[model samples]
Target: MSLMLGYLEDYAKNRRGSHNYHTILVMGYAVAGKPEFALQLFGRMRYQGIDLDVFAYHVLLNALVEGNYYDGVEAVSNQIKSRGFESEVTHSILIKSFCRKKEFDRAETYLRRVMEGEVKIKGGGYIVGALVDGLCKDEQFDRAGKLVDEFGEFHVYDIWIRELVRARKLDGAMEFLHKTRNVVQYVPDLFRYNTLIIRLLRENRLEEVCDLIIEMRESNIPPDELTMNTVLCFFCKGGMVDIALRLYDSRGQIGLSLSSMAFNYLMNTLCGDGSVVDAYRILKNALEQGYFPGVPTFSVLAHALCKLEKLDMMNELFHVALENNVVLSDRIHEIYIQALCRTGRVEDGYYIHGELNRLNKVTTGCAYNSLINGFIKSNRADIAVRLLIEMQEKGHTPSRQLFRTVIQSVCETENPEKQFQRLLEMQLSLHEIDCGVFNIFIEGAGLAKKPDLANEVYQMMKRSGISPNVTSDILLLRSYLRGEKVSDGLHFFHNILERRAIGRKVFNTLIIGLCKANKPDIALSYFTNIRAKEKTVRPSLECYEELIYVLCNHKRYDKILDVIDDLIDVGRPLSSFIGNNLLLHSLKDRELYDTWVDSRPPTELTQPESSHIWRLREVVGLFSDRFRDDISIDDLEQVVRNCFPLDIYTYNMLLRKLCAKQVDDADKLFDTLCPKGYEPNQWTYETMVHGFYKHGRKDHAKLLLKEMVQRGFRPSEVTSALL
Candidate 1:
């Protein structure tokens, strides 16, 4: 690598003013995993004032990522921003590196930066896939899905389906696939179908696999070879060999080509279950069709023949493989050995194992574990243990499940402490202990009603340097709550608050718990604290409504009003039910009603129309005494003019008050409003007609009704009835 770099440097020095030299040099060094040297070359190029393009920046960023230098990746990313270069490749590199390092928060932050247009990174499937994979590994499945939705890119569905399958969320994967059928411009392709089908087959969900295939065909997506094989393998494993045969026979009709793996799997499954004649018939048909079976098919069939004690048929299959130029693989040898052991041919199994060992093909733990499991199942536990020891001596770590099995066997010996110690020892030896293991213990203890044990497990987790996640905190919280240790739960809640470890969900849970315990006061205090201190915590409407209802039940009207005020201040209105409850409670007391009215800021009211009507009613109530008394026209007019804005509605309202007091001045006020551009609506014309008729001026009333009709304003029904 150094020699290569030296040559590139010499070439760059000789080929001065050529940016391609430096760019090629950087790419070569990056691919070689010597990214630091690439970065040094980049700096030298920059020193020489060579113009760097987006590709050059992309190369440097990729080099930093290849070296796992995250900080350097960040620095180069910022430099890209500072230099006004927009390279999607650089952004994708940064995202991929952060996700690979499991720094998902940084990955998400960069994604959001790109989304918000702070960074000029174009969103595509590659960057989205990396972040989504990171999120799924972190068990943020829903968030990853939502991120895909926010980007609205259908190509990211492959990543989403794969992650769901990895998380064992096959149902969710299927649902997402079905949902994609409705998305504009996104057709569920064969790759997506195969991903879900493979997972379903692993889960033994053959019925669902069949249904999905039917659905795929209905949607016009013909099943491919992989799909057919997956379905056939599933049917074979489920002991429905007849269905597997029928599907294989109709492969051409289903638009699928028969593959060797599928053929081998079917033959092997049939022979292992004592259907040798059927397996031979399928093999004969395939060979007649001129299809050459590969090494796997040959190995499986040969092993199956050996299982049936048909050494002659097995040798014939081997000759066929030789004729077809098929070379046997290590996997084939392993399968043959396992088949021999399963048939109680231990001597032959050992012979194959020795031959493979001489050829260096028996080095994998899988081979050892296969024989070990076979011995254990055959009532030869002592031999299994011996093989396990030999496997370790060969520098192969036995399968994790092997240790688990041994520990289970020891646990059945009825020594709890010893069993736990052995389990821990195994974990230490294998370095496989993680928070998830402890979480299982904690969850089990909680379910078992042993909060003390759960707490101990939690402490062990902390001592092991495994910081608790939200799930861990929730498990411990649930333990405390279930044990009725309210104080401990409260303390844990405080710790979460202090560290800001809890999200809105935990805060809500805490609040709801307190409220359910009849501690509305405490719940309110926490809700207020969350609203004030944590900008991200948005308490649900249901939460606020529940607390308000509790406060109202307790007749804590002032506090209820405060909660409503805060909710409004944040532009979140209380629901109508809660708002009506507040109104009902306030109306019972004059002082409380006044306080509620004054608490709401003018801008926070519902809508302009409703607010206008409400204010008009309030104004009328304020002048109720004056209206009842025999106030003079001038005094009433002065009061209406001074207190209201004199819009059409207000003018109509004031005119109605005036008409009952002084009909002449009411007519004068109507005339004055018209000259001031306040045209009379239906209400205005109705009020005037009624006033004229009451004052024994029927002629004037008739004239006004005609004018009302001419102006396209109809009088009220009451006015027409009176006429």
Candidate 2:
């Protein structure tokens, strides 16, 4: 590999050959997973006055990105820019850099600059793809859509842009895509089409995605594994178990091989959504094809069996994993045990536990925790306690999680205070109890409304040199609040705020308790005092909304304006639910808009309204499967009148759609264009001819051919093929 690399490096610098040696050198390093070496070679080659072509740049840029050497990327970019050669590859590299660093603005700036500059290396599908991906990542749909249009000269952008649209960046992706109405490289081979379709499926845009198999038939593109897997995933995502079974229906015709990874993804998705029977059917299909199932597939199957309380199915999946030489993970074994235990099979869970113990694989705390949780769930607290003791005897110290689970379980069965006291005593006999364990006890005591017990737990925590967390303090405060011990709750809240510095959530909980106890005035006093002191600290949107809600219920409408002002200043619009209620409440006060919209801070006006919902709809519309449906002649005319009046691409798209429906209408459409003061170019004739051939209308094709011959317009390969 190094020798091949050395030859490429020498060739790139020699500059004597027609072959692109730098490209070869860079490719060698990229393929070898040593992209840094490729960059190093590129740096040295630059000093030799040999221009790094687009191909060389891509390989090196990809290598740099793949190896995560981001800082080096800018240097190469500057070098390209300095030479006044911002090729598509250079732009793509810059876009990729921003994508990796998540600095989308810089990537976009470079893209626009690439568009503005002369063609150093003519832009292609990949350049547009990188920009679309970056914009999608940054959630900047509007600009991405426009950029797609600018780069939509090639049909490749259609496939990737569709992918972006499917990824839910449809509005930005479509603005560019909708400009070109021709069937983009519609059959962009199988891989690109599959990628776009599968992405659409993931985004739940099934109705919009067309029958890809049928699309391939129309376009004469052969179907591959990628195409089949895409459709299979769609069926799996849609819960169309019968459609998934159609793999068997087409296996003989399409020569399908149900790839293990694809099968695993389908099984996992189905099982996760509790479609175990569907998963089982898929596995059975795989079995019929003589393919061994993988570990993840079996693991999901086991999980589903556990959910359904099917111990026999769980065991069968477990054995299948082993039969297929699939290594069972601790999760799988734990699920198997839990499933067995739930169905009155504790002996089976224990037996598996014993087998793990014998193999000395029960060292981790996770497997033990799973078993203990299972026991607690089954009301077998005594068995859970025994298991903890067994774990300790094996020199594996019990985790705080384990202790908390067992203690909480014991509390349910008997006097929790007595059990906690016993555990505290037991802790003294061994090592110290964890702060987390004490916190858990405090929470349990608070939940049981035992303030004294919770206080005792807190005191124990301090004495053990295990300081209570904010959670522990909150629990203790809640205990006091529940008992209407306002002074105690307030004192604890202050200490917690001072010591642990608990945030809004804890503060909100305390304030809520005060309001519930009919101490709204006191709660308001505390709220005012907190707001005055903590300049940096502010209520969350939920806290502010809830406070407003409480005030509204008390007919304290005067106080709501202040909270609304705060919300407006913080740039939080009311949620749809709250907005409806707020509108009703605002009707009672003329000063509502003054507080909500014309707030104290002029800076708040600068904040953009949340574009999430609007952008989401726009994106959905862009990748919408609606476009694939057959458009009526009337609809085409309407689209032309409304959408095409200003936009050339829309006119072209409408023209293509209309011409597709009636091929001989090309002359009539051209005449209509002249009367409308618009000139028709080769694009118009090309689209009509392409459409004629696409639908196999040979008479219309011959007519166009005869016209072209008379007009002295020679046919290109595409035009010849159309004829």
Candidate 3:
């Protein structure tokens, strides 16, 4: 407008425009809301003897009033009247001008004067409608209502209803809306219902909003996009998600384009309802409509989709976030990455993890864990080890199990030494070469059966001027035993003893490791040394159980009895593994029971109730016929349970003994196995299979073997031969 005005002024200075062109210019500025310029041009028009017509005058007058320029309005009104071109628009403009200037009395006088014919102005509806609207705008709502009542015109009532709703008088808006619908037998317009409904929705008057929407339907007033969008929001927030979802689906048919708030509400509510897939669909549609959800809403829906393992949707969501430049929270990104890893999309997860890197984001500890484990499962532990070290460098603490997994996975590689050495170099370089870090390398080498490598790491630890802690000594000793370098292990153990007094933990690790290495003689020698102490430091119960198991494996029944005497002397209750071992060995051969009877102290057998020897004596009688009348297998299981909670191995022993006499007892024990929450292992299955075959139920035995194989437990050699 300014450009045009400037051009026109230059044009006029050169040559004048026609009267119609000049008038058009004045109206143009007024219509364009450049009232100052419009009035300036109007004054120019009058000076040039070019007067605006009635329509131009009224347009200028209304524009002045709208711009709150009462001075221009008065000047324009007087000019229209002086030209005798006054109409109802002229007085209405004056009345509106007075109201805008807060001169209510003058506005009301003009209305009365015009109505009474004192002023012969026409356009009664136009005149009264403007004043009532102005009154409502001025918050003279009661007076506006009275004016609406006095006129009793639908147009006036409609204007007042809009005013009421705009002022947030929702109840009054609805009341007048009902009046229009009831007494007047007319639906005001879509705007009326929509505005009222929106206000009601804002105030959470859901029932009323629903009623008004119904009213629109019953009145045959077709809903616009706003109405449908509002309804979708209402249904979603009110826990009527099914209806909301239906409305969302029919968005195209109903001409419903979702508003930002409606989209936010629908997606968030759907996720809360566990309708994650549907929420994902809505999110896709929302993106199409160019509505980028806020962070919280996107996160809620993204997490839900991830939880439900809707990977395809989560992938799309990730791309959407990427494409839109939506910076999701690290936690949300971590959720997607972890979910991908869980669903075996580790490569895809790693790809996204790179995205986090490019974004300069620190991957969460939990995500690193999942990704590392995922890579391990994929046999990419080389990659997993790198991530583990990276995780530590980023100041996140990897779980011991996680580190163990990476190390174990590395040990399982084809060239474990090369890979593990590579990993160890990286690990040691990540921090100072403390004993703890070197211990991990030793432990890893031990696990790889590379006792030589483990010894090298131990030496390196000493070279770093960090003397080995007991933990370090234990790891190196176990490494030797794990590699079956029993001589080396013995040397290391004696060196440890020479340097300092070791605790039960070190003794237990060596004893257990040696037992695992099948060197029971060395383990027993150490056990002897432990028992020979004046204040003999009792080995752990687990250590005792391990020694007795290896002793049973060696069939050194006399040695087993000697260990049992040491166990009794140490005041440690016999573990179920030890007791069950004795029973199983007795059932296999008379060696254990004979050893017990031969080594029995003549007076210890008569020991008081405080003595565990009595229990040991009864356990021996389980094999001999001497206790058959006094003790049943059921009685023995109970006695064992009372002594120490019976393990599954104990149950296997009981099942074996029962198979010799009553197959019914074995069947009973097998049935109770599941109810006792005992997951049957290979030994348990073998015991049952043996029981079945001996009882002449070959089909049952084969069936048990099949189940064992199905459970990933291979049948033992003896059981296979029987089958």
Name the best candidate (by TM-score).
Answer: 3
TM-score of 3: 0.65
Error of 2 at 621 (Å): 33
> At residue 150, what lDDT does model 2 achieve?
62
lDDT for each residue of candidate 1 in 403-492, tens digit (9 for 90 to 100) = 545433333343434544445444455446777666655564555445665687788889988888777777776666555666787898
Tens-place lDDT digits, model 3, residues 481-504:
999998889899889989998788
Shift in Å, residue 236, candidate 1: 2.7
Number of the top candidate by lDDT?
Answer: 3
Q: Considering summed lDDT, which 10 consecutive residues are worst modelled in model 3?
A: 624-633
lDDT of 2 by residue, 12-130 (tens): 66864567665566667877778887777676677776667755666666677767888777676676678665566666676777877887777767666666666544656677688
In model 1, how large is the Cα lDDT of residue 439? Answer: 65
Error of 1 at 484 (Å): 98
TM-score of each: 0.39, 0.37, 0.65
Give lDDT: candidate 1, residue 510.
Answer: 72
Candidate with better TM-score, 1 vs 2: 1
Off by over 4 Å in 3: 1-216, 222-242, 259-261, 272-275, 379-382, 399-426, 586-590, 623-626, 629-637, 647-723
